[model samples]
Target: MSSKLFLGHRLRRLRRDHQMSQTDMATSLAISPSYLNHLERNQRPVTATLLLKLAEHYDVDVRAFAAGGGTRTGPDELAEIFSDHLLADLGVPRYELAELAHNSPSVADAVARLYAALKEAGRNPSLASNDDARSVVTPENWVRDYIQQHRNHYPELEEAAETLGGALSDPLSMQEPMRKRLKNAWGITTRVVSQSELGNISQQFDAERQLFLISSQLRPENRTFALAYQLALVEFAGVIDRMVAEAGAPDEGIRQLLHMSLANYAAGAIMMPYGRFLQACEEMRYSIDRLCGEFGANVEQVAHRLTTLSRPGARGVPFFMLRVDPAGNISKRYAGDQFPFSRFGGTCPRWNLHAAFQAAGQVVTQLIETPDGHRYFTVARTIERPIKSDLSGGLLAIGLGCDIVFAHKLHCAEAYDLADAPVTPVGPACSICPRLDCGYRATPPAGRMLAVDRNAKSISPYPFLP
Candidate 1:
């Protein structure tokens, strides 16, 4: 950790969110307006005592002000973004990028958004048909950014889902009650149908017949989740639509995707009611398997639920989750902190998430140290989800992890001795990784000189000049 924490942007946002002016906020904190200004401008580092004061006064979690201070994007990400040849020649200093992200996260986020648009278009050049070049944000990427902006915690959805969950107790056994509610309340009928009937779709709701057809191929957990999702759509359609309207999604496709995601979030919340699930997580010491049995959810579903425990005052240990296919494409990501994520490529190959594919259905754990020296405890496993009829046999790996500081709270971490754990050296990706001696170097490091010595075969394929 650095001696000074530059969390001016976060503090400023907090103050603005409270509708408090600098002078007012300073007076409340027993600090001068000038000092508060200095703090907001990154002129002075935030102190531990001040962070405690913020928490005490605002009733918020103090962990957001720790380590990198929970910035929207860290310098690591900025560095990775600028490493591309298209932007590398711009000669943006590393500290400037950090200052940009720390002092003005919105602008930093704009940079990231544009980068996303470019990467998405680059990935599918023939499909890029948007003439309005100002913005080409992909549907999934845009919704993902929106979710991250809100910290993946939708208060309205949470409250509504919690209320519904209380009304419908025992999430695992709510299928019948939900079916009844759908039929009685919404005048809709739900029935499981064969794969041939539903075709490629997992679930389909036909409006004309007012019938909901769920694929019989789904597992027990998935079936319950599918029903819960349909119930969420019926129950929270207004709220979900209003959220989409407020989002100002670029197109209808994006709007629909966001709608699906919010409904999915609501369904997850319904299944794992916030208060009870948090209690269970603490009581069980964050055991994935135990929680799976307790909630009747699959590993991937349980892990995804773990990442959304980000309610303001009653927050759980901050955990990041990701889903990756066998081809190393990261399809989903959530939570942000010291963890190094590749902007668009596969994250560090050294991470054990990729290794879990070999040992399907088993949990794999690793103590990983990022290039920037942030230690994390990772829990990864190969998850098998019900696939479309056409694509029947593709396995995805789900990785769930948190900072090493919170590792002790997880039951899975009990096997490792934190004091002397064997740590894996991981980087953001091969394109921007600083390591020059890794035997598994897939590509040369960006923005570094490579040493070409054909006569002497080095251990690393792409040896670089230090």
Candidate 2:
């Protein structure tokens, strides 16, 4: 191993010696657990902010965390390439990068590798490599900005959504008030147009005419959500600005995009107020129909809301939410708990996500077992996205599923046998996932060397035992 890799290993060892979990360390530093894992594995470069946080949290001197202090060598350039991209794209002078190498070699190595990968892949491609991306944010400098800036908070929208409560249950009854709010806030009229008039099922804003068109298909819930999304852009522009400002980007455009995406989350939360939504989720037992009726939100909207409750201190059940098309392409994912996820490919085939498609609209349940014997209860069901039929847009069937631990208090527990009943084995995805026997596997795990014992072969291409 290289000096950089050695340094990361030593850092990880030190962290473990302190008896701290990755999540504990990440929470303390206000960084993602995945990023910490990357840094420990020498996959990500360390940053000044992170180094300072570690020093304050662990009460260690700067060199103590680097190679010269009690450690040997760090990783090679390749290892650093795997960290995050933003540090690589810092646009800092080479001398500064070299200075960091001398003082914070672990971080410098990571940033160098990140820049190497970025240069190799050109500037735009995100899936340039398979192993480095995180679930919530793409592996880019802009994503880092999104996270580091706000510490991932949406206080303003949270406050606004709290104030806008109760306008959802009877959208028609509240339409006048909602429309007035939209007009007053955005200077646009919220007009309910026929589905035929809507060129696209989307809620479009005609900036020139100052009119916002809502599809006729929109029920009280859809209308409320659309109105909130609009109001979020206008009423909460400052909040958005603050988020962008705090992101402290290496690039301006990426910073703006991250700002808009997060603003969308704020809008969604506003439509489904966090406190009420959490209460409704527990009360309704997460039944799509029941919760939808009680909260005036759709199934997809409810699932999406469940993923965004990652508010610090007052977090809801941390969930890993994913939506997959019939082809198994993971179009959307949110890692509320930082559970291991694949950025390059699809999820485990044995997961109930694929099975959910077999019976449209019917919820499917499964107990999934990872190779390490970790078990999770999964609930999956297919839902449509609601689009225009003119071939302009049409709803696609996507499966929505969440991890099991959070399902403990859910009423759906009775639906599955959580006992020692054998769980269907699964892997993260084809590339890094270890289940080679899966007919659905598209690739094999890296560095795996299979030895054939002519007479004894397990069902999988790779043996289950050593």
Candidate 3:
């Protein structure tokens, strides 16, 4: 709504792509070339009227830039990427990050992505590719960034899933229909087997026998999801391949990972179609439990699905979902809004996502204010792990949140006084958190000298210069 945008690079690119000089573009827009140069160089911000005119003449969707689209990187993410201890000594200025994000977004995104790969490689050496010619970014991070780049929404996948969802006679019982479709249409039989038979795997498809076997120990929601996943893979195989090809995946490993993740996304979409699910979400006031019941999805599934409701016209609350274990490892993340998520580090100790472990399966609510003074309404709950973040299906918790402005739309937020409610001050992580008074700080803020003293001590374990 505000005209405080610095999208000069985009305008310049548009003009260059159209093979028009500054003078020509300015003449077309009824402005002087000098003024156009100012806008192109980001010396002046574009006004609302100019933006609409550019959209009308050049056919640019101005909303893409406003919605943090066109590129995966943002100024905040650039700031966080440079805040790493590895680059802390460089002391990259804040305005430089802004300039990089605005002027050369593709380069900024590549930098952020490479930094992510470095972190992942440091974390898991076994997964890192030994080939020198190959990309440094891991397949996991590569595919994850691809999903994040699209905001975890694929229009083609959503449409295919809608067709799949239309074939479902009952949403309450999806396993039967998904199984029937897989068997009757694709001639792929579905069987629920024991974990031992599947060798501790959640699922296995025997191509020779045309069999899809799911572990009996797997949750009902997961079984349904697996079936939907299989159906997705079978029905829309070429579409997924084309998507992976378009993504420019470096290797077959990344392509396979993308295929799996995209199939999972499609499965989730099939389980919860866009229009029907969005209507149900509105009618039920975005209640996870009710949506779970209506869609036959688990809490995590419903919460994850909620993040994908970023469709243009029927946009729902822009929520971010985070899955973390007691050890502070973040396994899953979907940021619908700029939630200031730490890239390489764990969540802050002050956040109650970890506290959700105390009451397993019970949803806990909190209104947290970040150091940036942005308030978010968060709901956290514990779920059975069955995940790699914690081996042996140990304790794992997930937190779902949205900007405080949309908090009132949530069913859980109805119990709180949004205006007068007490808000907790939380940071990204102790290593980067600037809060000095907090005793729970495990490490000092980056680039700050610790205020060591012989005769006195501060409340924080890692006291630093203010």
Candidate 4:
């Protein structure tokens, strides 16, 4: 049998948002006021019949109750906050932390803000020289936040790329045009160099020689991208600098990283002009492989470009992209759909993104449902980085997903039953997953006490106390 649902806080919030008193809500749902009060207090579990009635009468999504939709803070963030050394002495349980986040989000936000301030203060270089006092904030985190805040879309860069693309006779085949433009516009000569000459760097510009060198190990498409990226740096330097200034980068390193990201964005835009790409997406139903073939780009490049189609007037489906190495370390992430990515640890092991590593160089698709009951259609594939020698450089798995509401518009979804497909349950991370009976859980969830029964063993390795 299914567990009873206790969404008292969510129901109460909904009632208040609708400006309805307990009696009014009870009357609308055809229930007694006393019964409604009991439900509001969580004394009585929500019944399936009442849930349907509430949805039917109030015109609210049923998921709002199933997932505690009003909760703004994720369970992982709460676990991290409560696990801090400052709060460790309190010994609060994970369930209680989850309750606080769901029932009183404002309090959770205040706590998080205070913790951030404490961390910031601890990072002050003048305050201390100890390693513990060192700042946790890095250029990666700052750049990630900046990109997330912008929803991974830059219209100014898109417009610049569109203009540049229009000037070219063939945008897909960008090698010749990029080379000519680099030489004519900037007096720079482009050349393909051996791996021994390039070393660790994929592309390098020698300012004194006015020469742009690319690693010969890179595929033709990647070499083209390198050239286009260099062109973007030279031509769109002012635009990229303005964007970095607006982001308020912490230091020169972060500013340079942001400039590189903007230059990459410009390169993608140049390869696939925004207007043409959006039309092609609609026509092809967002087929990655076909798009790659059509645009003369690689699978990873095509997937990354899809996430940047958030232009105001011509928006495509909003996607969340994640790239992880074999060790499950997140190397690149961009959230366009507010997808919760664990900040404390690796993503859930059950996600197909990890499974895709087993079948390298192949596309894998899965329908996934998070603990919050939000469903997504995920596509995962392994991408190999260019290597100069026989020694393999690195291989990473890229996952691109969107909310299930857009499943019908995707070619991958054609093989599945959109309405009744079986979804694999996953979470942000094992540290915050609330699924008590999950056999694949690697660690006990935060705030829960493990019940070690010497006499009777359960299927779950770390069964928690009820």
Candidate 5:
């Protein structure tokens, strides 16, 4: 809680709004022009004396001079950017990078954009050696960026699914109704076949015979979901095609992946028709287990559908969902809000999501705060994948969270005191986390020089140089 302030961006905005030159403002405040320039550029902090002077001279609120009103990019983001292997040899200091982000935001943004482009290019084998061709982007990354930019919600797909749901007798119990609709509307028959008969495919459709085949090894919920997904593909193909066309996906592979994702989205919408699901969520206090039981869906499906409740005028709680294996590898992510997630590295191990694996199939809840001071209420549980013959089944942990402002409405937060709860400070990843005192930290924060002492030992393995 240091009182030292860094309000350079705010001060620059104020001066520009009033159309006052730095020299004029410096003369009015009785400070040198160079000193004023330094303050505006974040080269020097705004001291308490200068803060009072600005408040009195400009007739503004003193609270405006408080810290935390400067940069849009957080220190963790800058840390991650500077930690890139390409810039590792530079050995830049963390405070310097923070200053660059606060003082020169546009330059910081350009660096971020360039880094993203390079990472995307580095994924392709052909572009690895061509520096000039690094600008060429991949269609898979383009589609992922498109989904992220849209916040994982598509109103058009929701509307289409709702319209289709209207034709069914019961949209929530969509298995039987969807089956009837497929048979009557599209003249397609669905059959549950043995794994040996179905070969390697989990699902297949025969156009000539007008038959849909699903492997019998899938769990009942998965079987139903597969059926719903197939119905979406057949019924909402036009809508999915239009979205993919508008996205301008370059390759057929990317197009197919986009189509599959859109189909899954539509299937979720159909299973939990937006309006009914929103009402159920409100009544149940956002309990995933209750929603699953009521809707006849599994926990994973319930959590995934929670992130898609972003319809306008009838929106539910904004949630972020992520799936990671026991090894800490992220398999799926969908954010309906601005929850910063690590893009290239493992998530913070301090999060209870990783601990959910120890108590498999049980839900764990936690109150976590990011380095930027935003707090969230998260619940996690482990999901078991279906086993197939000689292949072993795997487990993935699913985490669902919402901002702390909306925590009181969730059933998971009932046992804890929202106002007095002890929050676990978590970061996007270990590489960028600035929490020096965390006992479980595996690596020193990027851009900081580690001070290792052989003769004199401390609790932390790598004490950062001041």
Candidate 6:
């Protein structure tokens, strides 16, 4: 068909989708049926004035309102959402939008909320809408959807952890038997001391001493974690290496660290068998303290393990766990699901992970919303890392957060009044968030132009009609 005919046909399709007849649309546009029909049939073309009115009346992009001169294209929901009057109207930058989509939905959600906030603030001057500030859904997006897609549990680690338990003839002893086994198996020894004397050696193998120094700072849970790491190094190390190799981390520093973390987790599981731990966790009603007590582990270790339940068949509760510093820097992130975390930089200021510090040690529960309308439950608490020497350094204060699905399986969430308790709000950094009205926003929403109103006030920080 001719370009005019194609455009006319597309226009007709859009109008029909909206269930508007030619006469109805003509009446709305203050035009005669004959004229509207001519436009629809490609007998007459749309004028600049008509295009502007169509945009204003239909609340759609004039270009979108127009018919295509060329053939159809691929699925472009992102592109269509871009055409959104709210985004283009705000003058959010294109590169920013592209980055947000590519980076993660958490960032995109943040950007969307920030943009909405800006628009709302400009339209209505009230902080009441500040409630919108907390709608960040990035963490959950990363944890539940993205990370969960990958298997968290490694069978090789599980088998190795269990097998090592057999050789440790004296299971009750913390040091000698475990140490002897290490030396015999991998030329590594296990050492334990007071938390103060633990020093920088959390778990280090000295080839010279043939000793593996494990700080007493390690609680049973941490000891288990350290034990697991050591076991992986000794017994399952090859298997763990194979696992990472299969995962193909591409030989980078961070990837190497991640590989080591995975190895540590596998070894740790050997120290605390998965089936035993899962049963213990369930029997304990997912109580971190009780689990720690029964398994001789630490809270962090338990919480960390909770996230690794992604084994194909024999899985424990899958949880997304993150450790963030007081500064809101995500220090450690493990996705039991697909919740997106920025591959780089700090989380949005609005997230509750930062708020966990205020209530230190107390469990804080939250319900978060994303721009695309994905919702999730989050539970957060502050944890103190054990410190050793005065000269050496102090323990770092960090916050831990887990996705709500696992929270639902936990004892703390069941006891807490989540129904009435205020949920924490969050978003990705302003650079990634699409939110426009964020007073805390460091920059404008991507693709939106900053509109400064002189005469009349806009509800958002920057209001530009697309």
Model 1 TM-score relative to the real fold: 0.94
Q: Compared with the true structure, what per-residue lDDT tens digits does model 4 show for residues 1-466?
A: 9978777777888798689999999999999999988887778889989988887886655653575532545455777777655675688777898778766766875565456546655666454444542243555766765675566779899999988966763745878998999999999999998888978777899999999999888888898789889999998989998888887776688788888888998998888888888898999999998898778788878888898887644778878899898988888887555565575457888888998989998889999888778899999999887444566657889999999988899998899997888899888767667787888888776667888799998877888875
Q: Can you give the lDDT of residue 381 in candidate 4? A: 91
Candidate 5 lDDT over 330-360, as tens digits, reads 7787777665567556788888999999999
Question: What lDDT does model 3 reach?
Answer: 0.82
lDDT of model number 4: 0.79
**What is model 4's C-alpha RMSD?**
8.8
**Per-residue lDDT for 1-466 in model 1, tens only?**
7477867888898899799999999999999999999998989989988998998898757766655544556677788789887887786888898888887888888888888778878877754686775446888888887887776889899999999977876644878877888899999999999988876788999999999999888888888899889999989999999999999988888889999999999999988889988999999999989988887778878888888887777788788999999998788898744346675667888899999999989989999988778889998899886654457767899998899999999998998999898999988778888876888889887777889797898988999986
Best by TM-score: 1
Alpha-carbon lDDT of model 5: 0.77
Report, for all candidates in order, the number of backbone clashes.
Answer: 0, 16, 0, 1, 0, 67
| lDDT of model 2, residue 414 | 65
Deviating ranges (above 4 Å) for candidate 5: 1-79, 88-141, 169-172, 386-392
lDDT of 2 by residue, 1-466 (tens): 4333224555576577679998987888898899888877667777767777767776655543453333211222222233233343433444454345444655654454345445545544655665644222334433532342232336566776667654443543435665787777668887878887866556788889999998877656667678777777777778778867865544556676676677667667766777777777777776667867665667777777766664433556655567777777666665444344443346777677877777888777777777656667666877766543455333334443445656566666666656755578887655445565665555434444555578986565554222
How many residue pairs clash in model 3? Answer: 0
- The runs of at least 3 residues in candidate 4 whose Cα sits more than 4 Å from the true structure, single-residue gaps closed, are 1-80, 83-135, 169-172
Per-model CA lDDT versus the true structure: 0.84, 0.60, 0.82, 0.79, 0.77, 0.57
Badly placed stretches (over 4 Å) of model 6 are 1-151, 165-177, 183-188, 192-201, 215-224, 244-259, 390-407, 415-425, 436-439, 454-466
lDDT of 1: 0.84
Model 5 poorest 10 in a row by lDDT: 63-72
User: Which ten-residue region of model 2 has the weakest summed lDDT?
Assistant: 71-80
Clashing pairs in 3: none
Q: What CA root-mean-square deviation does each model show from the true structure?
A: 2.2, 10.6, 3.9, 8.8, 8.9, 16.9
